[model samples]
Target: MTANPTATEPTLLSLPAPDEWPHWMGARGDAQLAEARRLVDDLKAQRPSEARQVLRVWNDAQTALSNAASIASLFSEVHPDRDVRERAENLMQDVQKLDTDLGLDTELFAVFADLDDTDLDADASRVLEHTLRDFRRSGVDRDEATRARLRELSEQAILLSQEFSKNIREDVRSIRVRPEQLAGMPQDWVEAHPVDEEGLVTVTTDYPDVIPFRTFAHDADARRELVTQFLTIAWPANDAVLQKLFAVRREHASLLGYATWADYDAEVKMIGAGQAIGEFIDRITALSGERAERDKAVLLERLQQDRPDATDIDGADATYYAELVRKEQHAVDAQRVRTYFPFEAVRQGLLDVTGRLFGLEWTPVSQEAAGTWHADVATYDVARDGERIGRIHLDLHPRDGKYKHAAQFDLVRGVRGVQLPEGVLVCNFNRGLMEHDEVVTLFHEFGHLVHHVVGGDQEWVRFSGVATEWDFVEAPSQMLEEWAWDADVLATFARNEAGETIPADLVAAMREADDFGKGYDARTQMFYAALSYDFHVHETPDLTERLRELMGRYSVFPYIAGTHMQCHFGHLDGYSSAYYTYMWSLVIAKDMFSAFDRNDLFDPEVARAYRDKVLAQGGRRDAADLVADFLGRPYTFDAYAAWLAE
Candidate 1:
């Protein structure tokens, strides 16, 4: 995947620097906004050539600003400093303005619309086309007044999103539990975080701390308190943030001349329309609902078997009892699973899989040389055939100031001939809890990494690497998750540091448990997607009330009172009305995986075809076109539904 030296190296201005904090972020933002203004002025003066130069300058500046903002924002989420967060927010606002000034809908499209396809080289044409399509979707074609309003709303939405995430990051709730109450938890977890003077083991809402307590803590009251605290993140303040964000998004969409937020947002997505997505959701819900009901019945029965007098199962009992079900049905102990899949082995497994599938090599870089946000973070030089392709940083473990979620940040987007484009994949998975399933999480994030590193063939920087349809971008990463589950793939990485392979029976047990409670998992995801879409689509005064009403209808479990779940839902800001992308992308991912199943799971010929036809192409062609080309046929939902049966 490494580019030839003759290929353009990505501009240095576009790359993110590690040590430069708030000031670099501010300067980057100013540069981008200044470039955008230059472009506007050039166009107004009727200087076409100067206008084009200005556009290129703006693109480069925007890319750098965006990369810096993403890194700083992620850092502040974990670190929780007010200044860093505010700087990140300010930079984000500058980006939104560029999007508006350039015509969120039309400016991008205009770049491609007037291009003489043959005049520019292939790379330039691809970039131009990508930018054009992006503008079209962003409402660049809207009237001047509407476009102005859209820009304002866009800026407001960014501010609201940052506030929403900040509120959650700053929220720390404490609960007291006796030493005995933590009985079922692993001793390491309890010792790692102990409360002061109250005998309470304080656990934050961070996944590493929260998940284990939910899954293992023996005391019902203690579990209830933690679960409540986890769910109630961002609370009343976040609720207002979410409502404002939704309203801003809706207003932005309406100004762009769409009937609803969903309609406007779906225009550039794979589904193409709100109705199609709604239909897809309806079908999946029907199919999955039956399985979910049966799964819940068996689980509830098992719960009763354990605690005979327990009448109702609520939020706190969900994970604890689910663990019981997993052990009872599959004999797969989470702790035992962790013993085999150590952190280093999982990391090696991910690198190994990418090497095999994409003909790429990853050499670890020193922390001092890489200049990252934290000591634990590592950078890797991605190369192919002895040539540098791109670079990516893997911030794997949870840290104090790191974002408490797994996400891929596009630090420096690739433009053809641009050398050393950079990206970072930030995740908060437990290094200690190295369960077999955690391997899947690693592969999933690596999927995003592969997309960013491999697809630098686009002419325009904007269209480079996983910058396709918003809904379709997840497919490449989602497809990687399948490899993690395959035993053949696991054999390559699922070994001890001492080089002993994990037991076959143990692997089998984990696979069984992987399928266990999948129905419940699907339903839970559906609930979140439904809630996200409903929040954006509804045009009502009381956002909280509407959310409750929708939850009552869509959620299988009863909604807990006094908790504002939407407040902490980060995706609501950007993915509003489009959170269903997860499920939507799964359909395409499953279809793509079917190709490997047919040719050969590890077949180099098939892998090469994918690398050449899909990964190498970036967002130059329509996402569906790439999928169809790679699969040698149109994508269908059959394979996706069939996977659920397995």
Candidate 2:
């Protein structure tokens, strides 16, 4: 199982003490900011050299705060200390303010705009250019009043988003399941949960509790009720948060001189405009809809055969019935796959794959090196040719007060001379034995971890790994999913403690089952992308109404009553109109993977070229140019469309 970092052990958690290293770091940053202000006064007195010193001081202050904020943010969700959480949030805000005062935005733009063709500092030049672009997209170029208003809107939005997320984290619904209702569930799952006075098993709303209950529970009415409760998380307050956030975002975009929020968001993305995303979504929806109808018919036929008296299936039945279909058609069971893929084996397999593909080695670091998020979090040192390159911390699992999302948090970005080795990956996957599909999720997240550790070519921290165009950032990570599907790669790590191998036929059957409901899954994702874009692009006063209208046209399942999914869709503010990045990057990823398919899947030369040209370079070059150069041609959607056809 993918590890959930939030689970509790008997011992006390080893979180950072209030007076740890970051406290000094925070103080140092404040001092530097004060020094910069003093230097600015000196600059007004006509000392040009002193002005340069002030700029350096301001840069130093910004870097210190940035580092502290990154570490604190990751730790805050799981950190037991209230002080640490508040300190981290405060430092992040201070850094945001410093960014505004340094004139770093305009200064960096001027530095890049004046670069000579023959300049050897290409990495630094590219970093400056990227920073300038971010500043412009952030509305830093607006007049004083407009910029202040935009900043206020941003601050308000951040606070609201944080509060919304907190509510979801704390909102736990307890369910009681009798022994008869838990017939098909694994023994460990049934025992792990508590039993109430009535001898009914009580489970919380965590994915570990919710997913198994949805798939294995035999009581139809109980399953339906639980699913309804799960879907309606963070209801009334979160819905209000979404409404206010929508208005704030619209105003922020207007202040930046854009026609719609979508226009403002897509301006700095790789796609160049909002229209391109709309066209791409439309094209995929047409193909996905055809396949979805075919799959839905097959599912319905099976449902009738299994339950001759049942009339219709709804959202709650989807998972349970899908598992039944898999068992009937392919004789594949998710729980059986979990026995073969223990968490430790999957992690080792990923390390082995990276070692071969990128010529790197990993060594475990001391827990102290990880600096106290939780005792279970593991830190590792990444090296190539016996030389240390960088570090990555894996905080896997879920617990109370922890962030309930699966994402990679970049704690410290690596730059050539400016920053030390730094990075981290955060996730909330089950930590015990995992299903085969869960192993694929591991590979996908490891893709992000490797991206962070490989140290890109950019000279500044702002343009480092995973900091490029939002639409293009997913390409490297998505391409790694292909590795999980390969038998050769799977064989390297799919072993028991006694060195026994899993049967080859089981792996093949697992792959077949994995692709079984691709169409339905793809369509569901398309619905989210479409809904997110439509909500941002519309100028209407009611976002929920707009969301419902779009859902009616695009979503296969009927919208559930009394729930607004957008309230919990925290990514709406950040990714906003850029949700199509997932699909766009999938196209590029498929084309990139074709190289390995054409050559041998394990071709050393091909792997080496990919590592050098794409993964290692990061955002030093324009993303389009980098992709073209690596592929020896432009990216095309044929591969993506054809993959869906399969």
Task: Pick the TM-score winner.
Answer: 1
What lDDT tens digits, residue by residue, belong to model 2 across residues 241-354?
777777888898887788778888787778887777788788777878877767766677777887887555656887788887787798887776667777888887888887
For model 1, the local distance difference test gives: 0.71
What lDDT tens digits, residue by residue, belong to model 1 across residues 1-646? 1112333445423323554656665676566556555545544444344334534544554454455455555545543345656676666666666556565535444534664555555645555555666677677776777777777777787777777876776676656677778888875676777766866656667877777788878787788888888878778898777768778877877776777889888887888987676677667777687777677777678778878986656567877877877887889777666666778778877888889888999998876666665667778888888888888888888755556678887667776564356778888777654755567777888888888878865555666788778898888888888777777777787775566776767767777776767676777777778777777677667766776786665555666666667777778865888888998898899899888854257788888899888888777778899999998889999997887888
Error of 1 at 190 (Å): 3.3
Candidate 1, residue 237: lDDT: 92
Off by over 4 Å in 2: 1-62, 100-121, 309-312, 496-499, 539-545, 598-600
Q: How does candidate 1 fare on TM-score?
A: 0.90
